[model samples]
Target chain A: MLPDATLADYALRLGDDSLVLGQRLSEWCGHAPMLEIDLALSNIALDLIGQASHFLKFAGRAEGRGRDADSFAFRRDALDFRNCLLVEQPNGDFAQTMARQFLFSNWQELLFAQLQHSANDTLADIARKAVKEVAYHAHFANEWMVRLGDGTEESRARTIAGLEWMWRFTGELFERDPALKPLVDAGVAVDVPSLRPDWEDRISRTLAEARLELPKPRRWVMGGRVGHHSEHLGHLLSEMQFLQRAYPGAMW
Target chain B: MNAELPLKDRVLEILSQVADPEIPCVSVVDLGIVRDVRDGKVFITPTYTGCPATAVIEAAIGKALKDAGFALKVATMLSPPWTTDWISDSGREKLRAYGIAPPDRGTAKHSLRDVPVECPRCGSRHTEEISRFGSTPCKSLHRCLDCREPFDRFKCH
Candidate 1:
């Protein structure tokens, strides 16, 4: 098995993706186009945040540091985050949001399914719970993808635009970092490269069902894994981390 | 029922009376979340990790244990995850009586439409989903065509 430090970094990558994405989705609260959709988005966001806590907490323990999940989440600056670029991307519109969710959750569903049986027991346990939640999330996003793509002339155009805009970032999720190689070999972490084909197949089927054409392959976006991000993430962190940063140790 | 039984058994008995915060018709024990009580620790596996009600359930369990004069730790286990299949038969009956459709047994999580949800009020198979989400994440809102009543159906996980 790999060392605890490597395991912690791997966990942080998983946690930060959920944390950033959950924050993005939470921005939709009180603002989604409809009440049912609003509640659904918020519910999915809550599940992501819960999953974030589990992974981050595990990361904290593995790091053998005094810091915990809250510290890792609230105190870290944008440059320290390791989420994929897709999650940190803005929620452009309802269709864009669903498009992002559709892509990310589908990948997450597959990843968690494999992680549920990881050599690391805690990671495996977290994956077991996460897989069930993400299944619902992916399904929810898929339903919306179909609805918006087939809904009306305007919605169809917007849904297609959403998918195209988010497509470039999809490649980064499957990039196998050298840092994670040992853990993957040890069976303590997922081999991300192996998930690409299944992700592509699922995405192709969903796009076809939605009656939307797949965006042509273009230049792949990169760098969120090593902490370079779009301008949006910095602004998001300022808002999300304000309370914790300003009042260190404050509680409800 | 013997007084000589271990304190853990008494704590379990107490937890059996603690109602689920969201679904008042059933207790935490009946919901199958209370895994065990041993050596001053009360183990519980939350039903839905994302469900807002899990925290409330844990808090309620803790309060109940403390109120019963036990200083047990409420430990949460995420693996061996909780499933709808764990809900007791009595819990299912209570859910139906309370107007919420209980989860159908062995329903596949991906194919939500595979099993028909019977109306709790009229026992009609003519129910339709109004929304995939309900007041809580664990439920889906449905309307019974026969009774013309809208109710929440616990989502089968």
Candidate 2:
């Protein structure tokens, strides 16, 4: 049997991805450049929340903990989060944020594609639904990238700068942990290593299409797969978990 | 595709005629957003977020199923979400033929309304967005500069 810690760890990563990204997108809830875009962002937020719920519930099950999705999401410590480093990075500016989406959405596109075919039924169902959403997200990111890359010179420059800022964190996405080995062997999880090339190609193509050049990959920062994260995540969690912690068992 | 299959196929065939309320060019079934159907029950999720046309879609699906002699049970699953990629190839062609630019899948890096939206009037590709919100929540109001005709461009959402 896969160890309970192993399952929790995996669940944390998936949940964190959805939770962190959803938070970021939620910032645009009212401030989108246009109402249609506003609705679009909101829709994406809804999907991520759904995904977070799914993974957290599964994690609760795998851990044999009596915790539910809310507990898994709200009760976890900062050190326990397993989401990629890319998601926790704050929304610096719209350009910076879209750049983040461009990178992560590209990776997610492939990740979900593989997950949809996983031997595990729940993972497959989750992936199947997520792939459809991510495909739109990938489209949204791509459209924004093309606009920024192919738009006015200032927009192009900003988009490039944004990409540079987030590029190093991209490596964390493919960093495989030993915990994933058992699930991977059972075809329940994707080998982070296998996703590397496709992720690169897709990102490269989008960047190239956007008329933006990728910075030569430098020494990559890593460790989120093992529950280690950047300084940013702690601050984010404090804000998100604040309300819940402040008023325990509060309901809207 | 029709003669060989049973109730599911017939239901899908009829459901395909239920046009997308905003686009109006392709039926919901042909759009492939109908994920599952069992025992005369219909399961569909929206193609766009916060889509207000959901009521109309449910109504259309209900009406179409009833027309086909199936009693209705419809459920909408919002999880995993729906994407334009799920829009069928024929549906996309129908959209383009109806003079609306089709939405690409989410894997795209940028969300640019790059191509000049064709004027639903003269079919000229010199359109510009007047406002992102249009007559409905799922579209942007675009005006074709050439024809001085305003039309709706289905927003990339």
Candidate 3:
């Protein structure tokens, strides 16, 4: 039997992925280059953040920790977060950000599809409801990827570079850690190892359609599942945690 | 069999009375906010997040469910995120009458993505965007030259 701590940690890991990416997307709330795109990004951000809150709160309960979502979000240090490397990479230029979004949303779409059938009813419930929305997001980003790639020389260069920069983080999407073992065994989580082949095939095809290439394989960065993260996470956590850290349990 | 009553049926009928706070002519169910009724719980999700009007809608749903004789635990779902696609045609009409334009076909013209939006109020194909962000997050600020009136356009998101 795995420890409750492991399950709780895993829950936070999932929650953190949502939270951190949610925060990144929220940065575009009013700042998107296009108005509709602004609403689109904000809507996606809101969904991700909301999902994180639910999972984090559930995680707190499972851990028997006397904490809520806000506390978990605001109080965590960098070392405690467990989101994948792909989501936390900085949103670069529009093409870069779009490319990053394109890759992450595709991976997330596949992840949530299998997640929807999870044996753990809560995770399944979240996944089933989220699949439709993520599908839209994935489609939206992909459309732009294709447009930007085929449109002009500048747009093509930016898209290609953006995808390459983001490629290293792709490896983490399929990683397995101690915490996911139980959920995977229970058939309540997508076996990360199983998703890679299809994820690769689709990404490869999507890039080819856009006239982009699969980035050359480099040393893949791993271990975000166990709390090791890039430097960017600390700054993100600081911003996210600031308000709640300053004012505990505040609600208007 | 009592032709007069089944507890759940009567209960749902009463609960269905909750009207959307944004567009009162239609019930929240018509807006697709109320997804399910099970074990005396009302499961609901907003058509959009940060909508500002969601609190009032939830309160109304709560009151409606209670008034209907069922204790309700209203759950908010975020997956399968809400899109403009979910807005019923009737809800779109409610939006038009409420002074917002119904969503136009090809909200994004990959071809003319930069072109002017047609005004819903005046039917002027000659309209200009005043602000990308509108009076609310869901709307975009637009003005029609023909009517020379400013109005909100339901963004194509």
| Highest lDDT scorer | 1
On TM-score, the stronger of 1 and 2 is: 1
Interface RMSD for candidates 1 onward, in order: 1.3, 5.8, 5.7
Model 3 lDDT at residue B31? 60
Candidate 2 chain A, which ten residues in sequence have the lowest lDDT sum? Answer: A1-10
Model 2 segments more than 4 A misplaced: A1-5, A33-37, B1-157
* lDDT-best of 2 and 3: 2
- Fnat, model by model in order, equals 0.70, 0.13, 0.22
Q: What is the C-alpha lDDT profile of model 1 across B3-59, one tens digit per residue?
A: 687876777689889998888899998888988877668889977666678888889
| Tens-digit lDDT string for candidate 1 (A1-252) | 333888888999999999999999999999999888888888889889888998999888888876788999999999989899999989998999999999999999999999998999999998998898898899899889999998999999999899999999999999999989899989999999999999989988988998988899999999998989999899999999999989988998
User: What's the count of clashing pairs in each model shown?
Assistant: 0, 19, 4
lDDT of each: 0.88, 0.76, 0.74
Residue B21, candidate 1: Cα error in Å is 1.6
Worst 10 residues of 1 chain B by lDDT: B106-115
Candidate 1 vs candidate 3: which has greater TM-score? 1
| B1-157 per-residue lDDT for model 2 (tens digits) | 4567876777787887788887677888766678887865778886553355776898889887777778868887655556556777777677767766556556323434365566665877777877544555445567788888767665554
Off by over 4 Å in 1: A1-3, B6-8, B108-111
> Which tens-of-lDDT digit does each residue in B9-50 have in candidate 3?
554466447776655665675566766667756667765544
